[model samples]
Target chain A: MTVKQFFKSNAFKSLAVLLAIVIIAGGLLAIFNDLLFVSDEERFNRTIEKIYGGSATVEETLTITDENGTFDKGAVSAAYKMSDGNYLIHSSGKGGYGGDVYLWVVVIAENGKFGGIEKVLLDTSDGETLLGNFRDSFYENFTKHNDELVEGKYFGTSGSDVINNVVTGTTLSSNAMCNAVNTAIDFFKSAVLGEEVVSYTYLYEKYVDMTQTTIERDFAANSVTLRIVMQANGIAPSIAFDVTVKDGAITAFEATKPFVQQYDETKIDESLRNGTYFVGKTAEEIAAALPDGETLDPAKLEGLGLATGASRSSESFFRAAAFATANFEAFFAPENLTYASYVDFEQSTFTWNYTEGNEVKMHIVMQANGIAPSIAFDVTVKDGAITAFEATKPFVQQYDETKIDESLRNGTYFVGKTLEEIAAALPDGETLDPAKLGGLGLATGASRSSESFFRAAAFALSNYTFYLTGGEQA
Target chain B: MNKYVKTAVDGLITNNATFKLVLGTCATLALTTSAINGVGMGLSVTAVLLLSNVVISLLRKVIPNTVRIPAFIVIIATMVTILRMALDKFLPDLYDSMGVFLPLIVVNCIILGRAEAFASKQPVLDSAIDGVATGLGFTAALTIMGVIRELLGSGSFFGIQLWDFKIGFFTSSAGAFFVYGMCIALFTLISNRVEYAHRARKARELRVPAEGPLDAPGISAKEEA
Candidate 1:
């Protein structure tokens, strides 16, 4: 058709009308889009206004930096100094029941120092389905115990008044919320107020059987003094020690309370009571110096140049020193540790056997958390990814072993996942990402045992990568 | 009644978007998790429907038949975008609750259905009335379902905790389907009865026989009278 004829045709009219409508609609939308835009900062300010009951201008946006490398529980993502002198911190807490719990904590400033938390608002959550269980009063508890919170007292710990008010069904989310608030407070203390932020010594309680009562850090001396209380186990009475560690070596070890035999008053051997043998040894050296077995036999004590007469007393002292050393390493040099550190690597084994085709099957036996009768798994790998995982020996922890075994036996969670993907699926610490776990077909309730399975999978994958693929072993 | 009023009544009861015509069931089923969500979605749809219908009705003769569908869609999508932007800026809570379903209003069958079926053939005023009536019908239906589900599933009314007792099954997608199916059945039954009664009343008012034939095989009109 000629251009003039086409212009007069019905099809040409239809095209013109449609294009006109498109242009009009697009133009109208552009105008409205510009008119109704809500920027991120504006949205945050609105949220602040809603929570604080008044509009406050942003004085300045603060950059968040984890300077001390101690932000494991949670970290502040953004901070803002409001015109009203309140610091609004956007923080995320790890170890939530589902995943990370995000929160907006407003730290009220008074006299140029951290006053207390003004209010905490739940910004968002990953998979915390039971957030409804927490009421306004539960959050109000934070404000109620503000002074203690600023003084480095954490909720869910003994002697903290906030522990009593933690919501029952949503403990993980509650803990995560507390962590988020604490992270904000920690930032306020160190960055805002220029006060020394002390790390919690209670964090080291997980690495040892003994309780770390107090930890005093001498930053100038590059040393820490830990006071620990070893609980009475078997014939050993409860004993307390002042263990000082510097440069990863034990500088001082003194029994604050003398070791007394139960129902007997006998002077303990000098070598056992003095703690001089362990003064210069590091954690690895002390761990190596100890004789094998739960109880050091008389012959073994004699071999270590210890008087065998105080065998039980010597055993208690050495065990306490060993636990103190473990705690020191865990607190100071956490990078050197892994899930394998807690597991009895000597008892655990990883074997990669040849399979038909290119697939390789690995058998892993891991004994963790001092649980006897190691748990074992047979994993199949192809192209650096897990193809199948089956529990040959079920996890025999205090948890529901049957349910754990059933979930692990399903094993599709790890089937298509590579070593890095599996490791990144869950958080480093105790927090398990429920959304990721659900996507992987792992049950959140069986998280403790699931972690064991994950460790096993990691071990198998690392071995397969190292032996079969000539990759670096994790 | 005025023709405009009649058209609106018919849109609401006889040609209801949710229960009668069974259109826009996606938003109805998904967003009726709470009564507040139902109101928000219904009103948002109403605003979009009203604007799109008016625009389409005004341009009905100007647009050619071959490209009417695409033209209607572009108009409807524009209206929905404007509505979304307004809601996000002014009413963020409702916007967050509506979530992805807010944008999906662009393809909602109710707006497009009215544009094609009613607005294309009707006057601008009648088309606008039909939009409001149909949207209100949708709103009523969604609100009823939301009330039932929220009451049973969460034991709450519009986020107010009524009681702790709850049947968790009612909060699931399957529960939404069940509620939707039951509402459709009940609405059809009631509307059919009302329509039958109204027709009978109208016939009686005009002195016409309700059911019997005017002429029988053995009887003439005079004999039947």
Candidate 2:
């Protein structure tokens, strides 16, 4: 039969054609549905990019739903910024305790500093303590400091306070946050900042002395050598000080290790290398680096080093130098300097002479880095010969605990002994008697035990004035 | 008009499309998870079914006798397509939730069965009445199923939480099946008794062995050529 005849003959043929059309159409629609809806991973990646300012190409993105088949997108949305920054920097983290609690987080970063944190959406309904409390605790901080959204610096308070864990609740979460922000800071500084900033010191002092001479040296050229001496009679022990180079250009500086026996070696070294830079050809050349129209402080020189990338260690060293300079001024040029009373000076000298006839003397001088406004000293030399010298000031000991302990424990305790001097007297374990306290009339001793030494020293020092006075004074 | 209204109302509620007659089980079971969802699915199917019935009735004479089912399906499917597009644009959420079941409404037994049995034989208005009654009844039954499922399982009446009780029997898939079975059984019991009573009274009044099969409510007898 012909095709037209076949169609005309049977109604089943028409039904067959109709069924065929429907099957084709429905099949086409089913195919279309699969294409339009994106897989879950793409959405997660996009969200992560928004928060961290970087792309996160995660391998897997799991869509979580509650028992009610509803999800809170807002809670998950908070993770966008933190994961991109620093801290919880793991590519991924396993959740706590159960299969239910799936959490991931990253420390918050902005403008190259660790500020806050972000956590991926968590699907924990079990109400378990460790994971649930951690999540809750984290949200609590995020909400409280939610207002303190500074661009950088993770902890709401500022600086090292970022490392402080949540006090009473969610200690685990608090520790986690601390870990994340700390990691972020390290990553940002090491990976992003790319330089170590350091600081240096320059100090000068003038005093009324029998010997008259002018001294000059270049610090950046490494031609200058600094030595500090101490004397008793200070207003405050360990008073804050700074040594500002009023003028000088810092042409260049390379790190140098201090003597093993030196006082405050770690702190001084750190200060020198990490503090702010003042660059120029002379002491006066460096002061121009201060903020415009701001006066440089000879006491608080380290404060200037707080700028971004400033070397903390170098700034601290410069501050120490500035203190020394001011104290030296109080002793040498007592009338020339203000804010400190006059003190005596002792002198010593070094020779730079080549011949007897055309000899030149290089003077090596030690002045007080006057953290304490007490003893001051100087050194003098002329014509390649040692010049007359005397300690016009009363004896001064540097009051460092190490020196006192070294001397007292070795039975060689003396009133005015410095660490260098006491090192010569110590004989291992022999304890000094009270009778040996002679000249200074004080038996400087080590702590009763190493544990309480600092506290005891602080207590003794705080009540020194009261002790000096009789019971009547109390 | 009075007889027509009575027939339509009785067909619509008394012999519901899903419960009493147990027709269109595929769409009924697939879409009834909530009252809103059930209504949306039911109304969509109703619009398609009624339109197809009216058009089929008007063209019954013109349609060649041999290829009637194909022509009827084509008309019904076309109407379903129109409903699908309209629902997609206007009530997208319901359209999405209904998924493939909305298109399946064309092949629904209630619609096809009526088009072949009633619409093909009756006038356009009568056919339209049958379509509405059947579609509304189907909608009502599915909506009840949806309401029961949502309330028992989620402690919610259509997404609004009512209470949370740990009555395991009520809040489960088994519970849904149980409820649906009970409803169908109850409908069968009530309708069967009603039919029996009506039959007994009619038989007694007539005092004969029945003139024809027309006296029966649900049972149908095939006529020979």
Q: Native contacts recovered, in order, as a fraction for each?
A: 0.55, 0.03
Residue B70 in model 1: lDDT = 97
Query: What are the chain B TM-scores of all models?
Result: 0.89, 0.81
- On residues A65-133, what C-alpha lDDT tens digit does candidate 1 reach at each position? 667323656888888899889998888887687788888888989989778888887776736654544
TM-score of each: 0.52, 0.34
How big a share of the true inter-chain contacts is recovered in candidate 2? 0.03
Error of 1 at A22 (Å): 1.7
lDDT of 2 by residue, A1-474 (tens): 887887776565556655664575566445544443434564345335534446443333223223211221111212222333343332211111222222335545557654554543332223223331222344445534523434232432111113233523334333344333333333333333443311111122111110212122222232322222211112211212222332222333323233112233333434344333422333323333222112233344544333333233333333334323322222222122111112121232222222233222322222332342232222222322223222223344433434334433232332223323322222232222333233423323432221122121222222222222101111
The C-alpha interface RMSD of every prediction is: 5.9, 13.8
User: Tens-digit lDDT track for model 2 on B53-169?
Assistant: 898898787666676787788778767876776665455445545655777787888888889988998899988888888888878887888787667645567657679752445
Worst 10 residues of 1 chain A by lDDT: A203-212
- Candidate maximizing DockQ: 1
Candidate 2 to truth, TM = 0.34
Report iRMS (Å) of candidate 1: 5.9
Reference A-B contact fraction recovered by candidate 1: 0.55
